[model samples]
Target chain A: MAVSRGFVGRRPTDSARVPPGQYVTRDFPVLSAGPTPYTPLDTWDFTVRGLVNRPVSWSWQAFRALPHENITVDIHCVTKWTKLDTTWSGVSLDTLLDAAPTQASHALAFCDGGYTTNVPLADLRGGKAWVVDEYDGQPLDPEHGGPARLLVPHLYFWKSAKWIRGLELRQADQPGFWEMFGYHNYGDPWKEQRYQGD
Target chain B: MVSKTVETPRVTTIAVAIQDWPGHRAGQHVDVRLTAPDGYQTERSYSIGSAPEDAYVSLTVERLDDGEVSPYLVDELRPGDEIELRGPVGGYFAWDNELGGPLFLVAGGSGLVPFRSMLRHHRASGSRVPVRLLCSARSLELLIYREELIKLAADDLVDVSVTLTREAPDDWRGYRGRIDPALLAGCRHGCFGA
Candidate 1:
């Protein structure tokens, strides 16, 4: 490490933004929501709390066997690059909302790492979101928040929390980690909501 | 100072000429992107700290630990290295005399990048609005642009406030604490803009 700082060795290039391509399951896996993988299915439970008529709690297998599928899309990170054409599998937020029977005006998804993000119920049911379990064709990778990460395509990537264990539907809108520290709240790419002022 | 595009790791500063190759605004940030050996892409947005009047653009790149971007920049980039970047990417934070007042610049870590642009642009434009730049760093060694900033503060072109969070030398006489409101008041109010 040179005592002097502030020089980048390489030129900035879109050369690094890999094009959309095929993916498979091994490339992805559910990771790090809770402490372990084989969480005793019978003993395992997740709750859907936060602003709803009836909070639903269910076992792991019960949620798994309900219904599942996958989708492919592009992800734009706040760090400033757009990754195109990736695949994922998981339950749709619509399905979860339907089963959970929530009339809450708003919902905040909660997961491990004390992570939470707010999304309106309309956004979940309107085809803009999902509870993605698979990525790049594999079961989700833990680092990418596998097993299940919220897939909110319309908002910035962080809004889609990874390694999610539960949902806490809130009636109000609250900011998340980066938001509390000055990063944008909604984080809409088209709107360029990357930082505070905007 | 060079006009040609160079492939550099991280651009500490860039001076753009011609105002062409897709012109730029002072407060906007460009994406200085690169690819790691493992194929994971590392990209970061650096504010265009250079004054638009200047023939070129400049950005200050402060390295971060495991910083996929900055380390390569400060250590690997050399003169005439090719740089891939796209510019002028922010709006809400930019300076607009259309919405003018005394400016209070507060930066923690790398957050100061934008303010540097705003202040430099102010100087380049020859504006008289007083500006106070408060920079916080872990210690003296980590202070970016230390000599240049001190000169700027001493010149009184800008009122600078440096808060050292840890390991101050015995000779240290400036503020040696965090960014509390009280400490902030200790600075020149006329320059800090309240």
Candidate 2:
């Protein structure tokens, strides 16, 4: 069981690109709390509700009709894996928010299998977040939050909820599935906010 | 670090005693760092197999021929050795007493470590959570904690079943093939029906 490789320890080369306590990974690892959900696009829908004056809903056809931005960004997960130069195309949160104006300060992205992750309204707006359905110029894989998932590259990948179905606007911050357990309320990878009270 | 062979020639359970170790939840993992004498360092995350109720924090490592860290952990590491480690990391992939009942666990090969912690915790806490574990391993010899799992299952605290991917001993009563829908359904029926 002896492996002989002239091994050199990993050290952060570019601090600005890779966050502290994080390592760059070329392959996209599949990390999920549970099993992947496969919901047919024919019945898929997206909704923006909660603190909005009037909630708006979009069927699969209608959601795809919205203007989309082609983005290539770096994503960091709390598990210490960072995928760089990833590309995606989806409707920006600003566009979805514009359609249903809200006075809320917080947004919780709710998805299939009762998964939810909270993010500030400011984080979602101003081209910071997107409800993405396309990855690498192809339809999103269900295993990777296909049909659509929230893409907030600024925060930990868990904040970008997979299989996203709706956005629940809130006046107060609320913890989601992982957050309620022990994950940091705001998973800022740069700060290495992995566990609670970090 | 105190090392003991668990699944035999390849898998070893390393127990490291840390002072003032902040207790961990069942099914959590830790990041272990190994520093070469020349100061070259490598770290990898491993699931905790010792229950939170246990006195020492332990990790079970299976030597992967291509792994940079595991080979040293399984073959070279010995008792009274010192290594740099951090954690009780990853709060998301964990379970506890408060989150109770009808626990369903499925493990593929060495993936059984975390679930072992959960099962041990369930037994230690005296929680009556109905647990069913389906361990898919190459064979009985390759399965870690085989004896312990059998004892636990015999005690009726947990229902354990195995699916062998490679080869099973002739007259193997469990399963002889890869996990399919039928195997899963049979496990469910066996557990719930009884």
Candidate 3:
């Protein structure tokens, strides 16, 4: 998306990198549909279930015990802000999937307050996604999906649910809250899929 | 586009009745794009000010001296004008009465637009959800939707508090400073826990 409005001044070089309709911003705008949720760490848990013969669950300690990775990537929010070269440390979705193998082709990430977003299983595997708990060497702030959030840097940020608690594999794709409300089911920033049928 | 002055000269309410509104939850916003005759277009997003149940979608815009869109939107646009728009966008910051119970709203300047939608929805739906709104403005004159908010607060279901940062009336009885821990704590007891 190439935004050339006066507010989003454009240069030739910018079009080569930033996705269509997205402007690069040094500031990370805090955009939430509702109030920030505060879930105590002691009560937090991560689970992998649905369509799997044997489901897996992890307490906060158990999840932290898994192998972790430090990653640096750029993230784009569907609301049109892009933060580049962000660093995060967490357990990769690949590692989580390997723990409890499944044959399902789609996944529904379940978060606190019943928020869920569906993604193709392929987009999640191969080092593309992670359950991130730390940002820039600090515990992720609750404002930014604190305890842990699904990090799918390749897609629009809404697919990366905050306060995420689990991933439920499924045989069929089920659109999440935003998806059901006209947001693109598969939000690819490069395509500028901000809404359904975009 | 239909425009009305909501607060001061810089603040104006723009309403449009489109066939595809589909209705939106309170606190949702729409992205608007304005195009010049030569097709040079600029887009900015604004919070929708009308309740979801209203017949038309509306946005309250605050004109900035240097802003490209707001200047034209606030000063040049007239009734029956056309502009491009998309949205009712974002899921992270939306609320409806269905979320149930106590709602605490905090506003700074034009930030009151989305919360206005929430309040309207609450009143229109006859919801009994306890709502407390803490609004911070430069002064009473700049407060948007003042009359409606006052009317809403007349009901036991709603509570309204205002803090004047720049200028306060001589007889002001409300908060006289900016939002701080003390004021936020007051908002917490009877409203949303956080």
True contacts kept of each: 0.10, 0.12, 0.00
DockQ order of candidates, top first: 2, 3, 1
Candidates arranged by lDDT, highest first: 2, 3, 1
Better of 1 and 3 by lDDT: 3
TM-score, prediction 3? 0.79
Error of 1 at A135 (Å): 21
lDDT of 3 by residue, B53-154 (tens): 887789999997756577777877777777678777877678888888788888988999999999999998889888889999898899888888888887
TM-score for each prediction?
0.52, 0.85, 0.79
Best by DockQ: 2
- Candidate 1: regions farther than 4 A off: A1-76, A80-123, A126-155, A158-198, B1-22, B35-42, B154-157, B188-194
B-chain TM-scores per prediction: 0.76, 0.93, 0.93
Better of 2 and 3 by DockQ: 2
Steric clashes per prediction = 41, 0, 11
A28 in model 1: Cα distance from truth in Å?
Answer: 20
Tell me the spans in candidate 2 whose CA falls farther than 4 Å from its real position. A1-8, A12-16, B6-10, B33-44, B63-72, B89-100, B126-130, B188-194
Regions more than 4 Å wrong, model 3: A1-13, B4-10, B15-28, B36-42, B51-57, B63-81, B87-106, B118-132, B147-159, B165-167, B177-194
Extract clashing residue pairs from model 2: none
Highest-TM-score candidate? 2
Lowest lDDT 10-mer window, candidate 2 chain B? Answer: B185-194
